[model samples]
Target: MNYIKNMEQEKALFLANEVTVQAGQIVSKTLAQNPHVSITLFAFGKGEEISSHDSSGDAMVLVLEGTGQFTVDGSEYVLGVGESLIMPAKKPHAVFAKEAFKMLLTVVFPSAT
Candidate 1:
């Protein structure tokens, strides 16, 4: 099945809105979902953060707006809009929004056991 659409209507699910996180508020949305991939959009309020955790599969984070820091295995890396980071399976990682920011998070999981 083809899910592609024209740019005009594509903005429907790609818009931003407020979301609440442990540290603060954020604006986010989910763009796509399939058996193999899931993509979500995030807009984090300043100081917002996600606690460190490990994933069962590989994941990718693409910064879409503002600034923030991502920690992988205890090492911190500054990130800005247009930047992307990859997290391998079982590695501990987290993200903190230094300022209100937007991002796209994509995760690819292993086939069902």
Candidate 2:
């Protein structure tokens, strides 16, 4: 089974170019998903946002291009290219596009034993 999908394997490529930002939309591409972990790529148009929510797993976001605003437990943070942040599990977090941006998100869940 392919744990990672929607992307080429063993080839040179830019993670930022894996997805695209639309005029007024949020686009996402899931690279891997399972009970243990999830990896995804996102492209957001200016003004786009993901409303506040809590997750069962810790989530990390890496900025690939442009700028993004992250709200974690009501605290706001701005991130630019090559920056990263981790949203602790069960913490209310949200993401917004300060400008058109791309990001890689990885979440790791506790073992489902």
Candidate 3:
């Protein structure tokens, strides 16, 4: 199933169908990519995390399942299903999964703003 909600608009599919979280592993899928923006899906297993990093583009994470703890610019935010947060361009950020989780990530490059 194609889980990219906004991409491949010629057809329709649910976000839950795109990718799945697994034991001790992280999964991801790229729905679209361009100079202006990129759409991707990520599934993180419990206790998994992505190291802190800075992005040239503004990145938004939309939680689709379970829970995630986000550190953006030195502040921590805990999000559950349906929650979303934007990490601004050039800011330090990291993501940690307290539980198995899934999310849609949209990054908008500087040129697009």
Candidate 4:
């Protein structure tokens, strides 16, 4: 039985080591990969920003829904909606929403071919 129901009419949305961004209407989704672990998704609108980054592996951030501010290495975290944070690899992270936000990010990879 092969059954896949509607991921926007599903035709290749399996993003391995993924990153998606849309500004103007504001949309952002980022996933790393898995079968070991790596996943990311972020959506923002009202003052969206995701700048400053550094990671070769080991990352986690989950705040699915409105309000956000997460910055590691410089230390700043003010999040809402089920908040979460864990970051270590290259160590430099950033995110800001502050009104419209949706996020779920997980990345864990060191060595596995």
lDDT of 2 by residue, 23-106 (tens): 799999999999999999999999999999999999999999999999999999999999999999999999999899999999
Candidate 3 backbone collisions, by pair: none
lDDT-best of 1 and 3: 3
lDDT of each: 0.75, 0.96, 0.90, 0.68
TM-score, structure 1 vs. true: 0.76
- Model 4 Cα lDDT, one tens digit per residue, 23-105: 53455443335446766566667777878899888787777666788889999988887878887889998887777767777
lDDT of 3 by residue, 15-68 (tens): 867788898988988887878888999999999999999999999999998999
Model 1: lDDT equals 0.75
Pairs that collide, model 2: none
- What TM-score against the true fold does each predicted structure earn? 0.76, 0.97, 0.88, 0.31
Candidate 2: which stretches are off by over 4 Å? Answer: none
Worst 10 residues of 4 by lDDT: 1-10
Residue-wise C-alpha lDDT for candidate 1, range 11-59, written one tens digit per residue: 4543333223334676556656777777777878889889999987788
Error of 3 at 91 (Å): 0.4
Q: Which ten residues in a row have the lowest lDDT in candidate 1?
A: 14-23
RMSD of each: 4.2, 0.7, 3.5, 10.4
Q: Which candidate should be chosen as best, given lDDT against the real structure?
A: 2
Question: Which runs of model 4 end up more than 4 angstroms from their true locations?
Answer: 1-9, 12-35, 40-56, 60-67, 77-87, 90-97, 104-106
